[model samples]
Target: MRVLVTGGAGFIGSAVVRHLVNDKRFDVLSIDKLTYAGTLTSMVSVNDNPLYRFENADVCDKTAITQAMSDFRPDRIMHLAAESHVDRSITGAKDFVETNVLGTFNMLECARAYWQSLDSRAKETFRFLHISTDEVYGSLGKEGLFTESTPYDPSSPYSATKAASDHLAKAWERTYGLPVVISNCSNNYGPFHFPEKLIPLMIINAMEGKSLPVYGSGSNIRDWLFVEDHAKALDLIAERGRVGETYNVGGRNEQRNIDVVNRICTLMDEFRPEHGPHSRLIKCVEDRPGHDARYAIDATKLEQELCWKAVENFDTGIEKTVKWYLENEWWWSPLRQRYKGERLGLLPSGA
Candidate 1:
C-alpha cells in the first residue's frame, strides 16, 4: 500500500515513516515544509530506500498538496505536520494557527477532492489519519485520565490550535463523509527528537554539564510514549480504526516533571559518570504561561478496538532514549547548536 505522510521529516512523523518504509513494506511519499523542528536527518536510516520519496512543500499550499495527492495516489494520508512546540506557540501563536489550523483545513480539502475523484474500490480503502496530542484535553486533575470523550479545555496556544484542527477533522467526516480517523497521543520521546522539547533538552543539557531547568516546583505530570510505539499504533489505527472515531494513545506511564528529570540524571550518571552528581545541575525556573498541572491519557479505546498498546513503558523507553542521544551525537549536535536548552512560554508582565 502507498502512504502519503506529512511532516515525515519530523520527530514522530519520521518514526512513522521509518516504520512504514522498513517494517510494513509500504511505499511512502513524505511531504514536509522543513521547518526548524523538521529535519531530513531524522529519516537518515531510510533515506536511500526506493519506496520512500521526499517532497519539500508546505501543507498550507493547496496547489502543492493537491498535486502531491494526485501524484502519490496514496491509499492513506497520515497528517502529522504542524508547529508543535508549546513554548514556541506561547511566544508566537500566529504560526501555530496558520500551520495547525489552516494547514489542516487545506489538507482536508485536498484529500476530500482527491477521494471524490477515485473509483469506488480505491475510495473505500482511502483513509486520512490525523495525528494529534493529548494536550488538547488540557490539564487533568490528579485523579482522572483523559479519555476520548473528555471535553477539550486546551490551556496553551499549541493545544488550542490542535483542538481546532481536531474539530475540523471530525466536522468534515460528518458533513462530507470523509474517511478520517484521529489519534491524540501523549508526549513522545525517542531517537531523532529535536532538543527543544523537555526530554532531549534535559539530556543534552546534562551531557554538557549545563544547568537543567525545571519549571516551577516541577510537579506537573505527563504521560510519556516512545515514538516507535506511537508509530506502530498510528499504523494500526489508520488501517483498522473506525471512521470518525477518535482514539487516545499513551504509554500508560505517568510521571511528574521533576521526577522525570531526576530519573534522567540518575540514568546519565550511570551511563556516563561525571565528577559531580548530575542532579546537582537541576535548577528551578519560572514556569511557562498557562502551564497544565497534569495530563494522562486513557488509551483503552485504542487498545481494545485496534489491538494496539505501547510496548515500551517509561523505564525502558527513557533508557533507550538516553542511550540514543549518548550514542548519536551527530544526530542531535546540530540541533543543540541551533537551540541551546532554554526555558520558554513566559506570560507578559501585564497581560
Candidate 2:
C-alpha cells in the first residue's frame, strides 16, 4: 500500500511512519512542516529506505497539499499534522485554530478532490484517516470512560480545535462522500517524545536534579498509551477500519499525575542511583487554566473491530520510556537545550 502521512516527523507521527516503512513495508510519503515539536532525527531509522520518502510541507497549504496528493497518488492518507501541545495552545490558540481547524479543512478538500479523481476500484480502496486525541471529550467525572458516542465538551483551546477538526472530518464524509475514519487516543508516552510533555519532562528534570514540577496537587488523571501501540492502531484503522466510524484507542493504563511522576522517579533511581530519591524533587505548582480533571478512553470498539490491543501497560511502558531517555542522550539532548522545562500556558502577571 502507498500511504501519505502528515506530520510524520513529530512524536506519534514518526512512530507511525517508522512502523509503516519498517514493519509493514508500505510505500510511504512522510510529509511534515518540521515545526518546533517535529524533528527529522525521529525518522532516522527509515530515512534512507526506498519506500520511505519525506515531504516538507504544511497541511494548511492547500496548493502544496493538493500537489502532493496528485504527485504521490497515495491510496491512503493518514492526517496527523497539527499544533498539539495543550500548554502551547493555551498561550497561542490562534496557531491551534489555524492549523487544526483550517488545516483539516484544507486536507479534507484536497482528499475529496483526490478521491473524486480516482477510478472506481481505486476509490473503493481509498481511506483518509484523521488521528486525534481523547481530550476532546473534556473532563470525565471519575466514573465513565470516553466512548465513541461521548459528546465533545472540550476544555482547552487545543482540544476545542481538535473537536472542531473531528466534526469537519465527519462532515466531509457525510456531505462530500470522502472516506474518513477518526481515532481519538489518550495520553501517549514513549520513545522520541518531546520533553515538554508530562512523562518526558519529569524524566529529564529528575535526571538533571532539577525541580520536578507537578500541576494542581498532581491529582489529575490521564490514561497513558504507548506511542508504538498507538502507531499500530492508526495503521490498522487506516487499512481495515470502516468509513465514517470513530474509534477510541487507549492503553487502559490510567494513572494519576502524581503517581506517574513518582513512578518515573523510582525508575530513575535504578538507572541513575546518583540521582537517588528523585521523588524529593517533586514540586507542586499552579494548575493550568481550565485543566481537565481526568481523561480516559474506551477502546472497546477498536479492540473488537480491529483486533488491536495495547501491548504495554503503564509499568512496562513507563520503564521502556525512561530507559529510552536514559540511554539515548543523543536524541533528546538537543531538544533539552531548546526547551528547558520552563512553565508554559501561564497568563502574564494580570492578563
Candidate 3:
C-alpha cells in the first residue's frame, strides 16, 4: 500500500515512515515542513529505500498538499504534523493554532476532495488516520486513565489546538463520509527525540553536568510510550480500525516527572560511570502556567479491538533510550549545539 505521512521528519512521524517502508513494504511519501524539531536524520534508516519518497511541504499549504496527494495517490493519509511542544505552545500559540488547527483543516478538506474523486473501490479502501495526544483530555487526578470517551479539557495552547484538530477529523468523518480514524496517544519518548523535551533534555544535561531543572516539585505524571511501538500501533489502526472511532494508545507506564529524571540519572551512573551522581544537578524550577498535574491513558479499547499492546515498560524503554543517546552522539550533538536545552513556556506576565 502507498501511504502519505505528514510530519514524516519529526520524532514519532519518522518512526512511522521507517516502519512502513522497512517493515511493511509500503510505499511512503513523507511530507514535512522541516520545523526546528523536524529533522531528516530521523528517517535516515529508510531515506534511500525504493519505496520511500520525501517532500518538504507544509500541511497548511493546500496547493502543495493537494498536488502531493494527487501525485502519490496514496491508500492512507497519516496526519502527524503539528507544533507539539507544550512549553513552546505556551510562549507562542499562534503557530500552534495555524499549524494544528488550520493545517489540519486544510488536510481534511484536501483529502475529502481527493477521496471523492476516487473510484468506488479506491474510495472504499482509502483511509485517513489522524494522530493526536492524550493531553487533550486534560489533567487527571492521582488516579484514572483517559479513555476515548473522556471529555476534552485542554489547558494549554498545544492541547487546545490538538483538541480542535481532533474535532475537525471527527466532523469530517461524520459529515463528509470520509474514512477517518483518530488515535490519541500518551507522551512518546525514544531515540531521535528532540532535546527540548523532558527526557532528552535531562539526559543531555546530566551527561554535561549541567543543572537539571524539575518543575514544581516534579510531581506531574505522564504515561510514556515508545515511539516505535506507537508507530506500529498507528499502522495497525490505519489498516483495520473502524472508521469514525477514536483509540487511546499508551505505554501503560506512568511515572512522576522527578522520578523519571532520577531514573535517567541512575541509568547514566550505571552505564557511564563518569557521569557521577547525575541527580546532584537536579534543580527545582517554576512550573509553566496551566501545567497538567497528571495524564494517563486507558488503552484497553485499542488493545482489545486491534490487538495492540506496548512492548516496552518504563524500565526497559528508559534504559534503551539512555543507551541510544550515549552511543549516537552524532545524531543528537548537532541538535544540542542549536538548542541548548533552555527552559520555555514561561507566562508573559509572570503569573
Candidate 2 lDDT by residue in tens digits, 1-351: 999999999999999999999999999998899988899999889988999999999899989999999999999999999998888888789999999999999999999999999999999999999999999998998699999999999998999999999999999999988999999999888999887777887888888898888887888889989999999999999989999999999988888889988999999999999869899999988878898988888999999989999988888889999999988889988876775545562211100
Model 1 misplacement above 4 A: 340-351
Error at 279, model 1, angstroms? 0.3
Model 3, span 126-213: residue lDDT tens: 9999999999999999878899999999999999999999999999999999999999999999999887788888888888888888
Q: Give me the displacement of residue 84 in model 3, in angstroms.
A: 0.4
Q: Judged by lDDT, which candidate is best? A: 3
Query: Please, what is the TM-score per model?
Result: 0.97, 0.97, 0.97
Report model 2's TM-score to 2 decimal places. Answer: 0.97
Model 1 residue 346 lDDT? 19
Which candidate model has the greater lDDT, 1 or 3? 3
lDDT of all predictions: 0.89, 0.89, 0.90
Count of backbone collisions within predicted model 2: 0
